[model samples]
Target: MTFSIVARDGDAFGVAVASRFLAVGSVVPNARIGVGAVATQAFARVSLRHELLDALAGGESVETALEQALAADPLREQRQVGLVGCHGARSSTGADCMDWAGGLAGESGDVAYAIQGNILTGPEVVRAMEEAWLTSAGQPLPRRLLGALLAGDAAGGDRRGRQSAALYAVCPGAGYDECGVLADLRVDDHPQAARELARLVELSELYFGGPEDVESLRGDLAEEVQELLDHVGVQGDSVAEALTAWAGEVNLETRLTPAGIDRRVLEELRRTAGR
Candidate 1:
């Protein structure tokens, strides 16, 4: 009924999920900063998301946290879970889950990941996710998770067809306004839910994300920026100031640098000016 990946990359912990269920994101994924991530599906006990986080925050290993969370549940045999903590990764496929239900957990260098699914087309879906996760090591945490998620979908995601998909991740200072949330996006119902979720992830990067590198405003680039600012009716005494105003108006100020702008900002300026 669902397929998901839970992972810890550097200081970030996140989950990407797609399912035939409505609003799978609402019940399948949860994480706490400095704790870990959990995804409970296939007769999901939504409370397990927080229960697993609580156990992990209390210093339990991923395995222990999962075990403790599922210990008392009477329908545990019908529930599936995946977890990735600071220490390691663990996954559970319930005995009573539908055929082709299973999971994989492993480490790629310092990063840990768990991939699981139920009622999938085949085991190849999970395998594709694993391969993508391993090969996408150099990407940002959000992109890495999204890569694996899209791979799984391309490999044939939920057997019942895609209805919802989500990508969520968190790290200190990664979110807008200094919050820990990095990316929290979901396509609640869509024919191409996974791909739609990926599109949302890209938009999130442009809006909520900051720049990786910045270049000083000078010469032609500066002139172009000022022109675009004027075209957009954003007034300022200088190109940088006008750019700042424009970026702020569009909620992209985070990508601005001191006396400079990131490539994303430049591209956005071009877009607003319709060039």
Candidate 2:
């Protein structure tokens, strides 16, 4: 009924999942910065999501943690799970899981990934996801993870149909005010949940994205930019102050720097002022 990928990218770890069930995000995915990520489905042993991450945090290898977690569950044969962390990647597909249920794990360079699904169209679903993840080098973790999910959906995910999807990612101090959550997006219910999830990921990048390289505001450029900000109703005694206030209003404080405003922010201010 669901497909997912748990992966480690550089110092970050994340999970992306999709399902024919409503609000799959409420149960299927979990991640922690510097520790690991997990996706528990099939029968959906949600608690195992935390247990697996805790085990990884305790320095257990992916295989050992999965073995112990399965050992503790008398009904292990009905559950499915995927795990990836500092140690590596692993997955489990219980014998009692529905037909077409299975999983795969692989690593390339610094990235390790595990893909799993139950009641899926076939092994092709997992294979396509694996291929996509392996080939998405240099892309951001969320985009890479979401690309894999989209590939699986294209290969025929969840034999039933799409109802919900989610993307959860984390890197050290990546969240708001350095809180740790890099991205946590969910399309709780949508006819095209995977596509909707991709859209949300794009929005997350715009709002929470880091700065890009571009020339800084200085001299006459700074004054002209400040005039634009004032024209947009963003008031301040100075250009930097006005830009900072506008950044806060648009939830883009992360893009500000002592050198100058982000090029993207400056462009946005100009665009809005022109409008």
Instruction: Name the candidate that leads on TM-score.
Output: 1
- By summed lDDT, the worst window of 10 consecutive residues in model 1 runs over 207-216
Give the local distance difference test score of model 1.
0.90
RMSD (CA, Å), each prediction: 1.0, 1.7
- At residue 255, what lDDT does model 1 achieve? 87
lDDT of model 2 at residue 163?
A: 98
How many clashing residue pairs appear in each of the predictions shown?
A: 0, 0
lDDT of each: 0.90, 0.90
Off by over 4 Å in 2: 219-224
Model 2 lDDT-worst window of ten: 208-217
